[model samples]
Target: MVEIEKRNSILEVGAGGGYLLNHAMQRKKKNAQYIATDLTEAMIKVMCQRSNLEALKIFYAGINLFLLMKLKIL
Candidate 1:
């Protein structure tokens, strides 16, 4: 079996909607802190509203650092 620490932290950048973080909270070990950061306050607000987990931390910063993502779409 895979052993895990009692405390954990997951930081998701450009975490729009926070779907992955939401699922991670359910599957990961206890005492894990989920931090979701997005490029806009709108996205973060929406994510916080959609999320039922009280431990989730939502933060926003206006930065687009996804060069690879833009290239992929182009």
Candidate 2:
């Protein structure tokens, strides 16, 4: 079983390959919808292609940094 991060670094900056997200999805503990929101468009495409999760429902969207500011996330 993959160890869950204490802080759950899902929204990390400069997360290029998305190793953490892919790792979590591989663990089929529950049937759940996973959302992969990234700051970079290239990362979004790469993760969707590399994840290769057959049974997982994934929603990958590239969120702009400006939008984050509007949402008061930053």
Candidate 3:
């Protein structure tokens, strides 16, 4: 299991409908930030419809920029 800290920033790539992200957010600290990105606009729209995710920062991107940056490819 992943433990979220008070100042942690959580990013979820390919978050389809945000099922896992939503649950993870529940365990996050109040000051923690959650960002979810998906390849399709439909999935982002679906995530936006969830009341529990209203405060979530969502975006639509073709690829996982964070992963690429971690791998030093970006």
Candidate 4:
């Protein structure tokens, strides 16, 4: 588990490839949330595959507003 003094929620907009998002998730283990958004189904699939199940609350959406409205992209 990572122990960072200052932890903040991460809102990644247009997380197309998901590589950066995946890395960010791995870096911070506690009190950190990740929200990934993409405009294509194929991209979302790739993103899901990159994410680990152990993550706390990793959210995925087709657009930023989907997450903002508290709804799934699909």
Name the top lDDT candidate. Answer: 3
Per-residue lDDT of candidate 1, residues 11-72 (tens digit): 56777766665565555556555555666656665666676433223333844422101111
Clash pairs detected, candidate 2: none
Question: In terms of TM-score, which candidate is strongest?
Answer: 3
lDDT of 4 by residue, 1-74 (tens): 23432455666666665767646655654565656565554665566655532212333473322221111211
**Model 4 error, position 74 (Å):** 21
Q: Where is model 1 more than 4 Å wrong at Cα?
A: 1-7, 53-74
lDDT per model vs. reference: 0.49, 0.42, 0.55, 0.49
Q: Which pairs of residues have clashing backbones in candidate 3?
A: none
Ranking by TM-score: 3, 1, 4, 2
Q: The CA-based lDDT of model 3 is what?
A: 0.55
Which window of ten consecutive residues has the lowest lDDT sum in model 1? 65-74
Taking the tens digit of each residue's C-alpha lDDT, what string does model 2 give over 1-74? 43443323224345455676656545423434344455665665566566642222234474363111111111
Error of 3 at 4 (Å): 2.5
**Candidate 4 local distance difference test against the native:** 0.49
TM-score per candidate: 0.56, 0.44, 0.63, 0.55
Task: In candidate 1, list every pair of residues with a backbone clash.
Answer: none
Model 2 TM-score, 2 decimals: 0.44
